[model samples]
Target chain A: MYLAKIFVTHKKSILDPQGEAIKNALHRLDYEAVENVSQGKYFETTLNCDSEDKAKQITDSICDSLLANPNMETYRFEIEKVGD
Target chain B: MKFAVISFPGSNCDYDMYYAIKDILKEPVEMVSCDTESLDGFDAVLIPGGFSYGDYLRSGAIAKFAKVMPALIKFANLGKPVLGVCNGFQILTEVGLLPGSLQNNRDMQFISEYEPLIVQNNKTIFTNEYEKAESIMIPIAHGEGNYYCNETELESLKQNHQIIFTYENNPNGSVSNIAGITNKNGNVMGMMPHPERAVEKILGSEDGVRLFTSILKSFKGGILVE
Candidate 1:
């Protein structure tokens, strides 16, 4: 079995209001070094597959069909062998 | 004209849309389940507001994969009149029936209030009852109503007059203050404002009645006799 960790974020061109809010909150705490913040979603799924390549293909399909909206979100995933 | 109010999971405003047509407009309407495979007899399709699938992932993201969506796509492709208000608009964009995406409101606050909208184009079948450039009042209620699209798409929308309505005072930081827009073919429309909620004066404003009347006229061949 393989576990895929997926991260989805708003495209750079798109505004992230929640991220901005977090940045402002950080600024109040005197985190002056922080120049920017972006918000996104993360998902972890365990897939039963034959190989890493198969896991990757399934993960890609998941993101394209359901996890990430192609219109405004970009996503990336990493696979790890979790169980035998 | 017969209308179908698509009832998706978590669709809270489905009744409001049905009421707008049946109680106020005195028209034939029915609630169509999201799992239906076909939209066979409906003349118009209404995707009402409300967070579908609990807004999981993104607003309208999960709902796009609903069983009825393929039927909705086919209905839209037929150039039949389709209206999606608020969350419905989000679904339309999600399902690729319309262009652009609705993001979180600029202020990241859920705005629920009567807002002013200007009829940017009254030539389409949807807004034919309104005068060109006429400003009307409609209620908007959503947290993710900020409309976004690329500059090229915006240019094309402007050139094609697909922008049906624009906010008089931009509330959601939308590009070009776009409140509503039609597809390139002008048959499919998606807007963030609740026209059904404003269909009756007792509810608030009657500015939305014309929007429905316009649809009726479209089916009636724009005779404007009534």
Candidate 2:
């Protein structure tokens, strides 16, 4: 089995409105010199596959095809032997 | 005029678009499921608002790969009238049909309310019903509607009059307060507001009715009304 974690975010050049609002709120709270904030999403999944390589392939496909926007997000995966 | 409203899974505004086109404007409109492969025989295609694909991964990201999107691209390439609203707007940007990206709301919450929209380009087929600089009140409902584009692209859009709508009061932290934009060919338009939601008087305003009228008029000029 493999564990996959996906992180999705606006590209660096894209303005993050949610981040800007948080920065403003921090300023209102008297925090000094906080420059910027960016928000993103984290998704975790467990894949069922026969071999480690198969698990990697399936998980990667899911992340690239559905779980992450290639232009705006990136993802990573890990595998662990089950019933060891 | 014949129109098609693309309905992706989790889309909530398809009915509103249908009513606006069929009842309010009296145009023949069909609801096209997202899994469909073709937009053949359609003069115009509309991507309505709502949480397409549950706004999964990123807003409109998953929906960009829907089977119907290729048809949308084809329609756009042909210079047929295509509109994306709110979530649909996000999809258009994701698919590169239009520029810019929609980020999360500054408030980090879903916002649904009426906001003032200033018409920026009256020459486009979409906004020709309104005068340049005219302000109209339209409903907006979205969690990711902030528009962001690079400075050079922004400058080019301004120079080419691709900007079609601006926020009157800057509700969201969109770049330059832009609320809507058209493609270089002026065929594809994407807006963060829900114009179809405002097309009926019972819904509090009929300002959106003019948009449909404008497109119909454009199609009827020197051509048979399909």
Candidate 3:
């Protein structure tokens, strides 16, 4: 089996309201060193594919077709081999 | 003329759209389920606003893959009028029927109120009843209605006169104050405001009536009795 870990985040050009709110809260709590905070989603999936390359291809397609909105977000994934 | 109000799962505004067409606009309207693939016998298609598929992953993300979407695309390609309101607008962008994506409001709040909109282009079938630069009041209710597109796409929209409505005071921080836009062909429109909700004076403003009437007029070869 192969495992896929995907991370999705708003594109740099797009505004991140939720992330902005969090950053504001952090400032209020005296986290002065944190200048910015952007929010995103992470997904972990175990595929039935035997090869890591095959698992990566399937995961990339999934992210492109469903997990991410290309208009506002970008996504990247990492694949690792797991035990059968 | 006959209109079809597509009812996707979790579509709360489908009935409002149907009522607006049948009773207010005095036209025949039917409710078509999103699971259906055919879109025949309809003069125009209205995709109503709601949290389709519970807005999983992203607004309109899952709904774009519905069985009815392919037919909707084909219908739009045939130069038939297609109107999408709020969540329906998000679906259109998700399905590539329209440009831009709706993000959360700049204030990060769900806003439900009546706002004034300026008609930027009144030449299209969707806004012919309104005068250029005319201001009309419409109700907008959504958490994610801030429209965003790349600078290149925005320039193209401006060049093609695809921008139909712009918020008067810029309610949700949509790019260039864009409240609504149409496709290059001018037959497909995706707007964040709920015109169906404003069709009756009792509900609020009746200014939205002109949008539907305009579509009806276009179907009748540009002759509107009213």
Which candidate ranks first by DockQ, i.e. highest? 3
TM-score of candidate 1 relative to the true fold: 0.97
DockQ of each: 0.77, 0.36, 0.84
> Lowest lDDT 10-mer window, candidate 2 chain B?
B217-226
* lDDT, each prediction: 0.93, 0.83, 0.92
Q: Which residue runs of candidate 2 sit more than 4 Å off their true CA positions?
A: A1-38, A43-84, B222-226
For every model shown, what is its TM-score relative to the native structure? Answer: 0.97, 0.82, 0.97
Q: Compare candidates 1 and 3 on DockQ and give the better one.
A: 3
TM-score of chain B of each: 0.97, 0.96, 0.97
Q: Which stretch of 10 consecutive residues in model 3 chain B shows the poorest summed lDDT?
A: B217-226
Q: Any residue pairs clashing in model 3, and if so which?
A: none
lDDT of 1 by residue, B86-168 (tens): 99999999999999999999998999989999999998888999999999999999999999998989999999999999999
Worst 10 residues of 1 chain B by lDDT: B217-226
